[model samples]
Target: MEAKDDPAIIGDSEFTALLNAARQQDPEAMLQLIELFKADILRLSKVIYMPEEDVVSEIVLEFLEFVQQGKE
Candidate 1:
């Protein structure tokens, strides 16, 4: 079967496995993951913290640092 048809294709890709683990450890995963989740996170933050829009960038930067620290 082709990779597209193979259920195990993702498990065999180094990057995919790395990302899956990273996502579990870090809610934001990496940069692209941040982009993917940014909308949801921003909406949640608005509800809980009422943070300014500009604060989204700052919060994401801080979260990335925190996640990286835990990995090391």
Candidate 2:
């Protein structure tokens, strides 16, 4: 799939905004980020033959933790 046509491919500005919000510990923004990239994450997990639930959850958790760490 073309990157431009991919819903998982967010614009740079949107990504920056999401990163800022995540660093601020905004739950809604964090959820939005997860929802926005969920399809791509799941697809990747499947392509790698990983369990979707476990992989996705770990990814989300790690992402949140990483963002939170930026505040420290």
Q: Pick by lDDT: which candidate is best?
A: 2
Query: lDDT tens string, model 1, 26-56?
Result: 4434765566456666876676554566578
Taken over the whole model, the C-alpha lDDT of each candidate is: 0.59, 0.79
lDDT by residue for model 2 (9-64), tens = 78889888888988887888899888887776777777656677888888889878
Alpha-carbon RMSD of each model? 8.5, 2.9
Q: Rate residue 32 of model 1 by lDDT.
A: 51
Error of 1 at 36 (Å): 2.7
Q: Estimated TM-score per prediction?
A: 0.43, 0.66
Q: Runs in model 2 with CA error above 4 Å?
A: 3-9, 47-50, 70-72
TM-score of 2: 0.66
